[model samples]
Target: MIGRLNHVAIAVPDLDAACAQYRGALGAVVGAPQDEPDHGVTVVFVELPNTKIEFLYPLGDNSPITGFLEKNPAGGIHHICYEVDDIMAARDRLQAEGARVLGSGEPKIGAHGKLVLFLHPKDFNGCLIELEEA
Candidate 1:
């Protein structure tokens, strides 16, 4: 089952500018920037009160994040990631409840060395859901 709200991921065009904006506006500091070659994204994490905010930008045109930004030009919230105790169990429960998963099987390595998996937006009422084990 879901444990806590881990982080909210926001898609941005520029990572540095977005990090600066968050730092100036909310006093958030960039924890670390990670490059995920498989996902084709470079992510910067800004630590918040109990959770964190993730800024994502595509590494190239073929990136999935690029297509996402193209569809949502404003580059808004991409997904809400929730911390989970057992990823496989949580995924199974979700599937049993009629939620569709984006990937075929198993959680994969995500930003900050966390195991992550995504639930299809259609199954979550148009909100992209991410399950992460920390």
Candidate 2:
């Protein structure tokens, strides 16, 4: 049902500055920033050995990331994404196993050109879970 840890997303207030800091301080090569309008956030990816790190920022006030940053202040981990082979199957399996989904029972276009769905944190030991199908 799960393939690998794709990336750990972190919410940030300024996307460019965050990318610069990661590149300058950690020598991380940042990928091109992507704006996911449907999700109301822009993201920059930093490729790593095992998994990538995604920096997220709200596109507008209604964006969910905005609320996240508000509560976290210094910003924090948004969610952990796990790559999956089949999103529909995975959703069914998770639902049967009693996992709570955050949106409609359908995968949406997510970062890195993957189909993604989020499982409520309450169902995943306090961690917001993202299932991505490449």
Candidate 3:
């Protein structure tokens, strides 16, 4: 079902500081901030040799990241996204195995412009999981 680990998302209260840390201090190649209205987040991708690290910040008052930041003031790992050859098939198989899919059980355009779906954190050991089409 799941393929390679796509990216690990981290929620941060200060997007600029986070990006500066990665770009200036760590000397990482940081991508520009992209607003994902559907996901209610402004993301910056830090490129790496193998995978990417996504920094997520609230885009609006109702943004999900806002709530996450409220609970975790210092911010933390929000989710781990994994690639899937076929998103629908992966969703079906996961559902059949008694896993709960978040939202409408339909794929949404992700930051990479690929179909993505989120799974319940409770089912995945308190870590939110995102499935993105490969």
Candidate 4:
């Protein structure tokens, strides 16, 4: 159902400092900040040879990242996204297997401009999982 690991998302309180750490200290190729209003996050993608690292910051008052940051003030890994060949098929399979899908059980446009869906963290060993159309 899931393909390659898409990216690991990290929720951060300070977006600027996070980007600077990756860019200056790690010497990584960090991309520009992109506002995902629907998802309510401002994301910065750090490109790497194997996979990408997504830095997520709150975009609005009700942004999910806001709550995440509140729980983890220092920020931490928010979710791990995996690619799927067919998102609907993957969703169906997971649902049949008693997995809970987050939100409306519908795919949303992700930061990569692709259809994405989030699964309940509890079902996945307490680690939030995101599935993106490959």
Best by lDDT: 4
Could you tell me the TM-score of candidate 3?
A: 0.95
Q: Once superposed on the true structure, which residue ranges of model 1 sit more than 4 Å away at CA? A: none
* lDDT for 52 (candidate 2): 92
Q: Please state the error at residue 124 of candidate 1 in Å.
A: 0.9
lDDT of 2 by residue, 1-134 (tens): 68899999999877878988999988998988888877788888899988899899898658989889889988899999998999999999999999888878788877667788999998899999999996
**TM-score of the candidate numbered 2?**
0.92
**Best candidate, TM-score-wise?**
4
Root-mean-square deviation per candidate: 1.5, 1.3, 1.0, 0.9
Per residue, candidate 1 scores C-alpha lDDT tens digits across 1-134 of 67899989999977878988888887877766788887889988888779888889998657879888889887989999989998888888988888888877588987757888999988788999989986
- Reference-based lDDT, residue 38, model 1: 78
Residue 57 local lDDT, model 3: 96
Pairs with backbone N, CA or C atoms under 3 Å apart (clashes), candidate 3: none
Span of 10 residues, lowest total lDDT, candidate 2: 105-114
User: Which candidate, 1 or 3, would have the higher lDDT against the true structure?
Assistant: 3
Error of 3 at 123 (Å): 0.7
Candidate 1 Cα RMSD after full superposition onto the native fold (Å): 1.5
List the pairs of residues colliding in candidate 1: none
TM-score (all chains, Cα) for each model: 0.91, 0.92, 0.95, 0.96
What ranking of all candidate models by TM-score puts the best one first?
A: 4, 3, 2, 1
**Ranking under lDDT, best-scoring first?**
4, 3, 2, 1
Evaluate model 4: give its TM-score.
Answer: 0.96
